[model samples]
Target: MAYDLEEQEKLEALKAWWERYGTLATAVVVVVALAVAGWSGWRAYQGYRANQAMGYFEALEDAARGVNGPGGADAATRIKAASDTLRSEYAGTAYASRGVLVAAQALEEKKDYAGAQRELEWLVARKDQSTLQPVARLRLAGLLLDQKQYDQALAQLNNPPAAFAALFADRRGDILAAQGKRDDARAAWQSALAAMPANAALKQIIQLKLDALSGA
Candidate 1:
């Protein structure tokens, strides 16, 4: 009888504690469960988007290689369509930037300068940070140089990333040389040559440019 009384008291105490805290404990568990599920759902959605973007990128590459057909115009159309889809729907993905670059190159090869420029401009205008922005800007500068838009081309070279510093300087030399600014071109080439690694093959090419400028 004494043992039975002790067990009954313990049960009463547990019931009182649950009555005081059970609702709070249950709410806490529910919140944590929901957060975990939401995070998992977000990760799964990102994976799905990445896979879809990859499929389109592959299609873009295949069309660029003329795998779908023989007609040049048709190939260009397909390439443009694929690239546009990636740019519009998967702009957050790395594949979108790469797709645009490939499309730009193909269009440029076909002498579709306007179309290529438009694609490049679209990439440049994106606010999202991307490693490929420098490359796109460099290419755009080159295109502008080809068109003899001297001032506009120079604008694109501002504040390049460190790894691209030498390339930017070299292209600056090209633009200045075209403008008949021999002294400025020489200085820019000298900067590029100094920035390059000793073993870089491009070092020789830059040095040759410098030598030719000096001789001139």
Candidate 2:
């Protein structure tokens, strides 16, 4: 009977210790678990938003590319509106970058070079190391070339990403040709031809340019 009483006293002491620290331990565990869950949920929401924005931009591009009628003014206007909406809602997303390209294309077709230039400039400012950036630079250089800004066009073609090297070389050739630098133009065309795939028709075009330069 005495041993039993001693054991009960030890149990009571343990209970008191637990009562002193149990609430704090539980609160710490709950906070940590909730923090993990909240972080995961936030990441999921960001990914979902990014995907939704991409889908909407894809739809807008499809609409822009589809042929409507002889006069495409209405279609062009719709494309511009869609692109503007994307820029406003998803400005920080890759979809917004894509929308800039679409809007610039439409504006170019409409002969609104100023508007197209604005879109291209916006893209240039925001362009990163992603696929969109090189493509945007290529298009922007083309616009600059149209304005006879040879040096600016060449600057854009320089140090392009690996995926865009051939196209960049071809653009450089075009710029050089415009400047009457026949030898440099030929060299650029040859570089483009060397980089281009054997099956691509663009290689043949570059070869022809090289031959013509040699002939002259």
Candidate 3:
């Protein structure tokens, strides 16, 4: 009987404690649940936006294909329109960056370097995944190189991540070669060769650069 009484007393104590703090505990649990729900909802919204962007891009491609005008400037305009839609409707998605790349390439093909640079600038401003950012930076650097903006191009290529470092170095060498800095270009090419994989095709290309630079 005594043992039974001790167990009953402990149960009563537990009940009282729960009664005193139960409301606060319930409120905390509810808040946590709501927080999780909100995060999930935001992710869902982002995913939906990405899907919408893909649809818009497909439409834009179709528009480009059917576009008509002298010099394909009409196609450039269509691509720009699609890019604008992506910026307005899905700016937070990876598709937005992709749209920027496509529009920039189209503009570049039309000899609209300035317009292409502007799109690249917008992409640089966005928060993108590591892989995408490096690719964008590389392409932007190439555009700068085409404009003979040597300093800007070199700056962009100087600090790429490991995945892009070799290509960046090779581009830097190309820029140096264009600027008449043969020795510096050779050194850069050597660095590129060291960084690049030892595939036969790549090795042959690097050897050619070395031979050309050395011969010159």
Q: 1-216, model 3: which lDDT tens digit per residue?
A: 355888999989989989999899999999999999999999998787778899888866665564444637667777888888888878877777877887777777778889888888787767655657677788888999999999998887766788777787788888999899998998888888888877736657767987988898
Can you tell me which runs of candidate 3 are displaced by over 4 Å? 1-18, 36-40, 63-71
Which rank order by TM-score, best down to worst?
Answer: 1, 3, 2
**What's the lDDT of the predicted structure labeled candidate 3?**
0.81
TM-score for candidate 3: 0.78
Residue-pair clashes per candidate, as listed? Answer: 0, 0, 0
lDDT of 2: 0.82
Q: How far is 43's C-alpha from truth in model 3 (Å)?
A: 3.7
Query: Which order, best to worst by lDDT?
Result: 1, 2, 3
Q: Which residue pairs collide in model 1, if any?
A: none
Select the stronger candidate by lDDT from 1 and 2.
1
Worst 10 residues of 1 by lDDT: 63-72
Q: Pick the candidate with the highest lDDT.
A: 1
* Candidate 3, residue 127: how far the Cα is off, in Å: 5.4
Model 2 agreement with the true structure over 1-216: per-residue lDDT tens digits: 355887889989988988999899899999999999999999999999898888778866876675245646776767767777777788888889988888788778777777787788777777462768788789988988898988987887778888889999999998899899998988888888888888998988888888778888
State which candidate, 1 or 3, has the greater lDDT: 1
Please, what is the TM-score per model?
0.90, 0.77, 0.78
